[model samples]
Target: MSKWTERMTDLIKSVGGFAKANKPVAEAFHTLETATRADGILDAKTHELIALAVAVTTRCDGCITAHAAAAKKAGASKAEISAALGTAIALNAGAAYVYSARALEAFEEL
Candidate 1:
């Protein structure tokens, strides 16, 4: 299997094990997912694209794999996914810039 395919398979199995170990939390998360999907202005592709961006921002391997698959399933093109990832990269850099200023201020205060 390909690297991402294997990772996704492992993620699925791990999630199942987590659900078995903690049904209530898993159920709650499922409920949240269901609620999010129940009704929303954004189309599936848009939602999945946003999810992919967030996954990149958060540096979550599981989320990246899952959302990449979901985004593809939702008909997000590679260009669209790349654009979303670009936004994530920009946001991370912006966040670092803001935090660096804050760190400098803290150092000055010290």
Candidate 2:
């Protein structure tokens, strides 16, 4: 198998193992999975897009890689993926700017 497929397989196995080993984590996963599967609020495709955005914003390389693949599998086009990544960058930039402003305010007070 290709490296990317191997990595994704490993991630799936790891998460499965974690769920089996930990009750609380398993419950949390179950709840979140259920919510994600729920009708109306967001479809599976949209959820994957949001996940891709979050993975990018948080700089989770493994997650970004996996979720991007998942997004594609869920039928996301290249343009959609690009737009999602752009949104992530914008949000991350805004968050950094806000944090820098807060730090500057604290420095002034000091």
Candidate 3:
């Protein structure tokens, strides 16, 4: 198995233990997650890609691994997943770039 695959396996086992110990809370979370992830305007594949992008933006390794696996399972090609990651990178960089303008304005005011 790939490193990510192993990591995901371990993470799932750990989370499963915690969920089992906290069944009520876990079930509530599961219900919420399931409902939110259910198809609406977006298809499952597209949603998985979006989840991957959000995971990247949030710097959550577990989320990245989980969503990458899900995205692949949902038929997202490597190219499509890569594109989603690229969008995350660009948005993060763009946010910093835009904030730099504000930083400069603040310095000028000082």
Candidate 4:
């Protein structure tokens, strides 16, 4: 189910190989990820937590495992991770509720 964190180094090297094949775009994406993940206003743990939340919403198992590992390494507790996940869940639920209303209106129009 989850192999990303289990073999993160391999996955990263594989990405490098893929980027080499894809040329500029993939390489640029890697660079962008590096820049985005760098410690800025928020610490690494906070960033990783946010990334985990995004991973859940996107249904990316690899991302979930990877960011979670990173978050743990960055000193985030299980409770903090749970809280971040809760926010993602709440946001997704809220989005569904709002979109359901839109869908209903569209159905009425049709």
Candidate 5:
């Protein structure tokens, strides 16, 4: 009913269609996902929080919705999520700063 819920529902359907059309690639991705999560170094909540932060940085709406729900299910609090997002914000700014230096170098050269 809500905007995010509707988007997630549609995303699920689309992913299903993609899997059906490309079973091998889908299965491979699933395998990779499972293998990564199989490592017990991080708990589910921490993993979901990291995934949500990466999703924000990558600008993936589907990933955001998926990881947001997963983070909630894993008992990540709102403040925890905000902290993860803060890391993402800092990372993006750092990336921009690095790229700005590169742009300046290019301008000097060209």
Candidate 6:
């Protein structure tokens, strides 16, 4: 198998084990998954794409890699992936700037 496939398999195994060991965690995962499915606001592919964007913005390497792979499998093209990443970066930058400005105000008041 390819390296990506191997890594994904390992990740799945790890998460599965964790879920099996922790009832609360397992329940939470199930609940979230069910809610996402029931919401139907976005298709699976779109949801995966959104996940990829959020992972990129949050700088979660593992999540980014996994979601990118999932997005590809869900029929997202390279161009789409790139666009999503760009959007994520823009949003992250804006959010950081806003937070930093607020932090500066707080610091000045101290």
* lDDT scores in order: 0.96, 0.85, 0.92, 0.87, 0.97, 0.85
Model 5 regions lying over 4 Å from their true place: none
Clash number for each model = 0, 0, 0, 0, 0, 0
Question: What TM-score do all the candidates reach, one by one?
Answer: 0.97, 0.85, 0.82, 0.83, 0.97, 0.84
Score candidate 2 by lDDT: 0.85
Q: Write the per-residue lDDT of candidate 2 for residues 1-110, one digit (tens) a residue.
A: 97878878888888788888997989987798677767768766788899999988887867876787879889999998899889989999999999999999999999
- Model 4 vs truth, CA RMSD: 2.6
Best by lDDT: 5
Tens-digit per-residue lDDT, 1-110, candidate 1: 89999999999999999999999999999999778778877889999999999999999999999999999999999999999999999999999999999999999999
Candidate 5 lDDT by residue in tens digits, 17-44? 9999999999999999888788789999
Model 5 TM-score (2 dp): 0.97
Ranking by TM-score: 5, 1, 2, 6, 4, 3
Q: Counting only residues 3 or more apart in sequence or on different chains, how many pairs clash (N, Cα, C under 3 Å) in candidate 6?
A: 0
Give a tens-digit lDDT track for model 4, residues 1-110: 34554577776787678888898989787788899957587789889999999999999876877788899999999999999999999989999999999999999999
lDDT of 6 by residue, 50-106 (tens): 899998778876687688788988999898888888899899999999999999999
Candidate 3 residue pairs in clash (backbone atoms < 3 Å) = none
Give per-residue CA lDDT, model 3, range 1-110, as digits (tens). 98998999998998899899999998998899799767587888999999999999999988898998899899999999989989999999999999999999999999
TM value for model 4:
0.83
